[model samples]
Target chain A: MRLPRARGPLTERLVACLQRPPRSHVALARTDGRDAADDALALWILHELHYRGFEDVDDAWEWAPSLMSMRHHLERELEERLRAEYSRSEGSRSGQAGGDEDVVAVLHQLIEADDGPSLADHLLRDGTTEQACQLLRQRSVYHLKEADPTAWVVPRVVGRAKAALMEIQYDEYGAGHHDRVHQDLFAHGLAAAGLSADYGHYVDEARLPILEQNNALSLFGLQRRLRGAALGHFAAFEATSSLPSRTLARALRRLGLPDEMAAYYDEHVEADAAHEQVALRDVCAVLVADEPHLREDVLFGAWACLELEARTARDLLDHWAAA
Target chain B: MAVEEPDVRPAGDGPLRCRPCPGGPLLVRGAAQVQGDDGTWHDTTRPVTAVCRCGASALRPWCDGTHKVLSQRGVNPIE
Candidate 1:
């Protein structure tokens, strides 16, 4: 949690600013280097302040306006890059209705037609321990605080949708059992695998795509305008999580890790399966049923989830293959 | 050493039998059991039920084809 080593000038300057008292306004001049390099790390650090602040940095810096401004600049650049990289198609727009069709059906089509590169396949079939560890590191950025991003949607939903979210979140929070919380469980997995369980330990090593994935959640969650998107995001995540968790468990077992080490994934295998129904039928369906207007935003949330994840998967797999 | 009670109820069909209730059929494909709000187990006597192998299915104690999707997508753990 100590401030990670500066990857480039952006991080170098940001880190220096963070070490001091919070300022009302500070400007970060744009850098021409690749977005994935130093800018990503710097932006990730800014976002990380909202979670567990860096161990060495002042906690007050979490609310610093100057830091916020700098972070915004980096985020703007990252968003522009992402929009340029992926094009939206009309077929992808099929779920944009506030009509009578079940949102789950639309989600199913999205899942069925997704031809995105398979990170899970590679991990289960042939990933080396080094590569697996790297994947875990990138994921640890979020899994260490699992469910927190989606928690933002709780206040945004009501009645059945709110109740359904609480039911699913209760399990994610381990139902008042600290040891059973999903985030803690993930930490155990990380520790068992010999990786650092401390928050943001690998931020320095994480590339832009990984950072961007987490940033998307924060982006959707923090905005009242994107509440529908947040719900859709959670639905997509829960809907898609079960099989990958099972595969991750198997991959860990294949590598000869103990059952305890695989317990996190094992838990997800049961938890998310049940969650999918609640998410699809009770949560997303009910939310759309009530709001009607958020159908498009919800679908966008789901699509964004898939898009960012695909990019992260491609980035990791491509790097691993090259290595 | 303390021993754990075996919940090995047989899935009754031919030789398969429910462990707890000797005459009761073993729970398997097409059959489901739901734990009610009061924690009572209720048998769902449907002809074809989707079973969850993936832990993510929200209708716990019930299969919903999520595991199949995960497997077909090559995201199943055994892959």
Candidate 2:
């Protein structure tokens, strides 16, 4: 819950300024835009204020104009970069099929086109204990607060979409049972695996790609204008989760981890299988059906989700390979 | 002497519905239990549950999303 160690000059300046009062005139360092690690860390810190504020930092800083301006600058850069990359890869692809096309089929084709290597497959087949723990540490950054990003969309939607999203979220929130909350289940899994189960425990150790992944979810969720993208990202996530989660659960059991750890994955196997249908058919399909203009943004969000995940997967795999 | 009761309850005035997805599972939106091939009943735990239609699921009576993979790989299990 404390401010994490600074990754670069930007974060250093941001953290130091955060130590002071919100209204105090503290000058922030200019970012060179080349140090992505520093940029991502700074953005992550700013986003964290909206989630759970750091222990010694005043809550008023969450809305401080200077900080808000800096956040906007960083978000613009991130959004531009994501769109550029999307366009680069999207050029050779076919044109956007209209609202009349089956959105669910388009989503499936998008998923199938993702030729990224499977990190889950490696883990399931022959991952070592150290490798398993490394994955858990990195994944803790997002899994600890799972489903919260998409929860932001509930208020932004209406009618069939809202009702369907709530139905899926109800299960994610444990369906009226405290113990069944997905985030708590991951926390329990972490504890059983001998890792620190505290929220934000692994934020300090997170790499740039991991931070960017978290920032992307926050970016899509926090902005009301990006509601279509948020649902798209959520749909892509659920579509990809079930099978990978099954593999992950098998890897956990193979590593001889505690039953609770594996049980978390087991829960996702069936849960996400159903969620995939609801997210794509009921949520995204219905939303686009009502608001035809958002179809492209929805597709962009889905593409961005897979692209960011592929980058993170490759980063982890390359690191493990080099070691 | 004790009276025996049947497992089936009379249909009540509830809005329970079962909708089958093409090439996928049957989505049931209420309190329901699926009797497996082994004769064991599995209770639905979520707000909506996917009852496996493609028999290729690892989790019996519940869809594990294997049908998508199968369909993509040219297996065409549903058809």
- DockQ measured for candidate 1: 0.08
Superposed Cα deviation of residue A165, candidate 1 (Å): 1.3
TM-score of chain A of 2: 0.97
Please give the lDDT score at residue A148 for candidate 1: 89
After superposing candidate 1 on the true structure, give the runs of residues whose Cα lies further than 4 Å from its correct spot: A31-34, A76-87, A96-100, B1-67, B70-79
Put down candidate 2 lDDT per residue, A1-323, tens digits, no spaces.
Answer: 88999987888888889988887455774845558988899898899899888897999999888787789988989989998887777511532643456877777778878887788898888678899998899999999999988888889999999999999999999999999999999999999999999989899999888999999999999998899888888999998999999998888898888999999999999998888888999999999998878787788888888988999899988998889
lDDT of 2 at A296: 75
Off by over 4 Å in 2: A29-33, A95-100, B1-14
Task: Residues A15-53, candidate 1: write the lDDT tens digits.
Answer: 787787777776566655664667767776787787778
Q: Deviation in angstroms for A76 in model 1?
A: 4.2
Q: Supply the global lDDT for candidate 1.
A: 0.70
Candidate 2: docking tier: medium
